[model samples]
Target: MATSSFSSFILIFSLLSFCAIAIPEPRPASWSSKTFGPDGPWNAVEVVIGGVGQNRTAVFPGHAWHSWFTSTDYCFLTSSDHCNDAGGYPLRNSGSSRVSMEFLQPAQEWMAGVRVAGEDGFMYLDDMDLLFKGDNTDYITKTSLAIISDQMLALPNGTQYPALLGCLSLGSPEANQTFVEVPGPNLNGTMIPWPLAKRGATPSSSFGLHIGSGITVARMQGSLFWGGYDRNRVVGDVLALDGGFYEPILLKNIAITVVKGASPFAFPSTSKPGLLAQGNSSLSSSAGLPIVIDPCSPYLSLPRSTCDAIASHLPVTYCPNLGLYIWDMTSPKTTQILTSASALSFTLPGGTNTQTLTIHVPFRHLNLTLSKPLALAPTQYFPCYTSSGTRASVLGRAFLQDAFLSANWESSRVWLAQAPGPNIQPGSNPVGILPGDTAIQSGGNDWATSWDGFWTPLSEKQANGTEGIPAPAPVGAGNKEGEGLSAGAKAGISIGVAFFAAGLIGLGILLWRRGWIGPSTSGFARQESEIALEGRHSVEMETAMPNSSRGGGWGPVEVAGTSVRDPIPLGEVDGTSSSSSKKGLATSGRHVRSLHALA
Candidate 1:
């Protein structure tokens, strides 16, 4: 009797299912945003690693390495313990705080980045204690470890970490290729990119960076973003790299120009040879030039031939023993080059059939300094170093100082744009770069929103500001908003509203059949598909990455883990900067006829 009654109810429900009705799709949820304090989704967020000065230590976090900060970004270990190597001078802070590090893993993993005074540095990763949570960002703020790199160490004659620490061996929660992945047994460690994604704060594993200009010129603090980019930091055309986000860029030309008379005098022209090509570039020999962008890299490591060419024009001398150019303080050429020079331009494929991209790094930006073990006293030097022949040449912090970079794992896309010059403060408005297929949306809100004026969408601005081609518009948009509805909009609404009533009636009937509402078939609660909550206490995720044939060449410092000789971390960056006047504006202009030329 019960089976016959159930069969009769199913037959009636199937007949009612033919009604025309609609169900709206649910909105995607994400973190909300703000103009100050906490950053919005995909906006700039500062990750403090080291503390500085004597008075402000209390305000910093627990893991902050309180050390003396320097303008020139010389990489150092903050721990107090010294290594076996006593040959070099250390770049660190006070005597109280030393390099606080412990190495538990047995394998000495060979890493890339940060060319050391000796060799590349390597360290081990501890796995058991860390989980990525939006509230507690240990994977970013302070390191969660049992023990790490206690063996091979250098830097800090006896001090602590200062300023910011950029790149590390921390692997992405998704793919290590996205963030700095240290390929272990199976991509074992977790880093910054993962937490943002796991928490739904970011649409995907992505980050944007703009290190800001030198203190001498801009005095701007660096900007960092998770899963999104600041729309204002970039100016001119946005170049989408042809290669993978993990690979090097193709350099079309590099020219240094000096203003002479009316036009600009330039060198390293196609025929003149300003910058040379690197043989060790990941690309083919004929492919223009390959340059890796590293925030931790303090100096601009280029081809030796390029350095030779640049040296001949300036007063700086290359001391092969030191692997750097020495600025002869007494030379008149030194003074002239520093003040009279105009710009050093690096031209790249503009991502268009017609236009090309050019980033003019101010000649004044190349000024750098060396102190202590590397030098007897503080000395100013040009920041160009000959590229080590092992891997691709590096376009370190020196270049990033004037360039904008954005990376995304979901889209596997990387973008490069010219950074704004000194004294120009652009507003902060971060937009998220959503997941695979890379359909971008308004990040701070769960629903997708289109970012206007993001790519300089205006016609006039696109022409003068962008330089040439712009990247594609952001993908995806949420509910539409407007003052008045158009014919199509009105029609869509009418259909939607009409279906709403019908949909409710259908829902009632379905509920009744399922013993959900006003029903008495069995009288039991039905299981819900999903639940909304106010958030939990903890969020955990797995870590690892696939092996890749590509990587950047870092350095010689070793953090004695396991001597298996495998690729490791990318180095850190900081440059000595001074922004006094270039000297003799009218004086130099009058001498242009006898001074120099553009080409």
Candidate 2:
């Protein structure tokens, strides 16, 4: 009985070990990782713009030309699509529309109609993600807002109106080769792509924004993600945006404080709220102002009164020539302020457990320049401006440098978190945002165990089925067979193939060293030359011929008997008298006929 019991224990131990080896480990669901820019954080993928079969252009992060404010109170593409002929006429004549006409009928069908509203011109539903690579891998087909080109129009008195283009036509006659058209079925104005629409009864679709250093600094890069965010990129706890305004994201009870004295003041000061309430009525009297976050603007534009309060404490002077206040970095008084001024922090409303959201901007980040073309020269400046008659304060790219913003349009909520600086490396693994009301960590065990003691490889559908979400179509796959393996499995197979290729290269080198392969041809061939007749008249060709004079040494030589003109040089001849030499040659009938026969 003791021997039988010991044998049963051994059998059970052996089975457990086999199960551990055969079962694949469960991993969190995630979208494929993409890189960030021409220069950006480590391990982050770089972003490029343009369409498939078109010239792809790298999107330079922190590039002033490409930045813009998030749309508020309007779907720019929708407005452009329904625009009248006055708005649509310009696109038909513009360079982008003419090229779209040239594409095959199938490609032309996908072209979103064009809109040209005076100076505000745009094309709708046209731009696409550069990484799509001819496949609808991200389910990003028939979406809006791909290429935006905003042109500034000068108005009366110096006021400028920005003409925003939802879809920019790359219509330059020279650059026609670079336009890439989106591939798929035609989408009507009302139809929304599955990816952009609300997902699984959720009120909002999730997206993450990581804005890197502005153009003032080098190696700047930014990241934008749809459906989820990189937790590793954020430093502090995620905070909720204020609950008013259906269009723009807003923050409440905002308070700003400058560090005083020798030691730097601790940020998010606990006593300042009460102190400001007692001392400064201008700041304390009102609730937080409606604000819009714009990545395109370099400076922070605040209410004129608020700017007056902040400027009173800092060492700043107004420049009449530039029509703006400049921070004199060279002044001794400014130097003293810089030493004590550690940072400026903005406090916002955070829901419940997380009481408040604060983003701290360092003094060094405030130092910037009025870049060329925007200014006459590169001028030292601070990133603060005053605005009058504005509905909301603008928190431009300057503020975003220190913050990570994520927006969930389907849920109608925005997440604000303090960002890791520009140099941090990205995490190897990233998780996708699950549907609303679904537990983030559940369903993995059930899917892993569904094989029921039979170890079958998990397909993408099976994994997504366990999570109660539909799997996106595999990129570039031609049929269902192509979808059998997951992206991770394909990546592993690719690595194996690379190793095999390296081994073959080593074998070729060994064979070459042992003289098993013969030498290759130099690619040149030899040809024989025939000798010229002794009595043949030789003509000297002029190295440089005059434009007006035709009868040079290299000019046509007329044979006496034949109408054909031979261009052979008989002797040294000048451009001036080649005609006389030709006449003499024509008189020698026998010699000319002999030359003609040889010609």
Candidate 3:
């Protein structure tokens, strides 16, 4: 019994241990760390928690914690208090006064936990490099590696920082760029303690501390992600295909013009609102397109401030339908000015309006190869008319300046070589054909016109009887219909087959009766025929004579073919002889009647 009890206890303990190991407790919020360069007053600093701990409360120094863009991926950091305690580190040091650091003037500061890498330190530029030692090094490494392991942030540019070491490239956050120091000094001319500042013990709206002496603060600048994108980069984001035959490249700003003709119900301008007065059109770039704005437009789903910022050009947007579209040439900024000069009526729900805009922008960057050199000395953007009455626009010098175009007529292959320009059709060489060539049309329509006739279509086969020749099908004819003979022909053939079958049956019956065929051919007719003939004969003989006309009453006639002969009077046969001549005459008449009946 004791052994059993001991076994039960052991089993329970093992089960509990297994459960604990399998389901781990929630991780601490402060498990990750952040690092800065040896230089003081660095530009733009953010403590990114690139892990499962994003939603967990973050305790930071001298600032309240607030959430920014919250999703499964990430949450922005803001200053706010009265939030739940993060599992990692609780803000510490409840005190009235705190340390501070001056960005503009780094010297003459008094506070606790003061550690300076250099006398006058400040981080400049978008990229930075630093080294950490002991505990600081470990913390930096932990944070950097943690964020990178999330696989959310990409380092395309070849730059290295204290904790993070990697290259950042195009389309990266670093490419966006930013400049602003996250952590600043407090009121006291000294550095603020991490725990105290995080806990709101010595909280200040800005990066300041409660101190008797004043300190010069720094104003750093940097981009979010990295360096902010330029106009060219912004435009490239649009018209980008993930997997396409043509590769897109950066297109520099080109000159352009906007046509003007005012009417009601115009596009984009009437729908969009801007700072301009009523009836005034203002076109600006939003996203990658040009947007026209009218005054007093209704607020969209976006925030009012955001909309205002966009209208004022504080932020750029490309909404083509909103009267903002990119053109071949012309700066987006210039287009706005042009609208004002033209006095174009821009209002909500404007009338039908037409505008002609010319821009020298690169339509697209293509990756192409040419099999043969193309001659573009005289013709440019010329039309390649096909015999099918379709036209293909060829790439002119305007599209492919200093670009090579190659074509192989035999292989029907064409390619744009070297600096991989845009794909455009080549002009038809009307003069290239030999003079008086039969392939050329009489109306000087070029060889292409005669290559395949347009109005006059050629048949699939010639009017000659040839087995291999292709033939055109009748209208509405399908594969099944084509496979079989005509319906009428089939019906006639079926009827002929039925008649032939009937004739065969009749011949078989005739042969069977003559013993030319088997017994079963007559179908049991021989016995029936014999029986019928005998029955007919017996019926005729019975009805012919009556029983009264017996034994030589009148007269007996002999059978012509048989040997048996007899002659008897009719009166004897009837068994009644008359008395005298008169009686005998009457009897003779009776006998004649009797004989007639028997016959």
Candidate 4:
């Protein structure tokens, strides 16, 4: 009897120990960030669309575009050949392999009008994947990766163009990006960071983006930190501002500082010239032209007078056809301001509650290279374009190159600081953020003292002693996950589990013989309701289309993505920190919100 009892004890102990060691507990907020995209500028990711077998397709926009722009890859999901020709976009064999939004459902019928880079398309709820290419691809699925489809025949001239690239819009309220689909896809566009926050994968839904300076000099290197910020990127005093969820970001005024060679820039102005005021340059932060800092804006769309004012001071001339300031190589001042330390600064005067932040952009950094399609050849042009048709005076991708933006989404607080060059620190200085009102952790290398104020350019090694071609993404690259246990370890665990199971059976037999165990019956019943979310929330009404279905807006907009009434799930995104656990994202049943009553 003692021997049998001892054997039973050993089995139970071993099984319990295995369970304790193998099962991971809930992890502390974990953050995983990686660099993405192809050589040249832009951030690229694998967008897999279509779920119905042959119709399912994957498109990597980085490889499709023959030209270079700011950070991002873009493509239209419309099934028309005209869309391919419209934007100088490469032909995709009559939209055969295009990501045709296989996840969309017509029965639920949720659609919204979407306009991008002058091209108009209807946005739809999609069950697709947004994979961030890294050492392992990190992804959020059953989410809206923005599958916009358009019929060229519906355009004013049937000649509209697609945007050069698309953006992973990280800011905004969760309801703005998409709504739940019946048997609904899991997450939405705005909710990308939310799952990380909810799963304890990140501290909060707050993320920071530093789109490094000088496309050629930046080497397409940047950081998108979730639940944290790269402290090495911040310089001097942090300009903290409130209100990221609704009101457009307003600045006191723009301050331009230039060298002797530049004319208009040499004299700092409190306000823009007369004609520029037509576009809202004269408006104050209280109202007027709100400054929208978006990574999607490929260039600096300043007011016309602002663009002309700056152009008058440089060796660049505006090309109306392309809407770009072509650099004049023959100009005597070209060598001066282009090479000299001239800076344009954006000032946001500190209110009693907000601290002032002045971000300086180097004049040299404004000079970007243009390739075929957008340009005839390798031409140098100023990225500042006239904000003729935009909703506001916009600081596009160009501005982000010098600004480090961090938003505490839970509290709706935003802070912008000067972004330091790559070598300002030895390593990618990522610091975890505490949830809510508490901001990001401080950096490992404090660069407040060493900050050069964009006066002198940062140092860089000339690749191959000349401007080298940007690196291409590795083959089979769009995968995401932590370095998990190897196959051998997994096999071992399986075998061990089986052995444990056999031992339990033997223990049961022994206990039964000793009358220490008895067979009992118990039943568990679980029922889950698949919830569908449907509705529409619009911010700005589209001109002439008072009834236009809208999905997103630069300002505060809530877009209800039609979702599956049945439960949809967001699979777990593995946390990278040691404190994290194996708990993946919650299943569809846990997060079903009934949004069927929206107008």
Most accurate candidate by lDDT: 4
| Worst lDDT 10-window in candidate 1 | 582-591
lDDT for each residue of candidate 4 in 298-337, tens digit (9 for 90 to 100) = 5666656667766766668877765668888775456444
Model 3, residue 14: what's the lDDT? 48
TM-score computed on alpha carbons, candidate 4 = 0.58
lDDT of 3 by residue, 21-124 (tens): 33311111111122111111111122322222223322111111101111121211212121122221111221222111111111101000111111211111
Lowest-scoring 10 consecutive residues by lDDT in candidate 3?
A: 209-218
Worst lDDT 10-window in candidate 4? 62-71
The C-alpha TM-scores of every prediction are: 0.50, 0.47, 0.14, 0.58
**Residue 52 displacement (Å), model 1:** 19
Per-residue CA lDDT of candidate 1, range 1-599, in tens? 99988756654544444343111111121111211100000111222223222221101001101111111113244321211111111223322322223222111112112232222222223221122223342333222221222222122242212222213322221332111222333222234355446554455666666655433322333445566766555666777753234344557667665422111222333223335542334222443555556544455667776677666666688866545687887764454444332456787775565667777565445655564335556576776766332244566666776677776655666677776544332235566666653332212221001122111222332222333334423232211112235689889988866756455666667768897676356632322112111121111101000010111321111111221333332222111111222110000000111100111
CA lDDT scores, all candidates in order: 0.38, 0.34, 0.18, 0.43
Candidate 3 regions with alpha-carbon error over 4 angstroms: 2-6, 22-26, 30-599
Best-matching candidate per TM-score: 4
Q: What digit string (tens of lDDT, one per residue) describes model 2 on residues 1-599?
A: 99988655554554454344333221111211332211111112222222343322222222110111112222233333211211211232222212121111111011111111121112233333425323233322222222223333222124433322122111110101111222322222111112332222112244455555543222234545445555544565566643211113334443444433232222334223322123346445544443545443334655555555555555677543432457877664454334333445666655554487777665445555653223454565656655312223456556776677654433445566675443333231234554341212111112112111212222333322332222222222111111346689889989856755555555556557889668886642312122121343432222112210111111111111111123233222211122223221221111122111211
Candidate 1: stretches off by over 4 Å: 1-166, 169-188, 242-244, 258-274, 277-285, 350-355, 387-391, 436-599
Two-way TM-score contest, 2 vs 3, winner: 2
* Number of colliding residue pairs in each model: 55, 21, 95, 31
Ordered by TM-score, highest first, the candidates read 4, 1, 2, 3
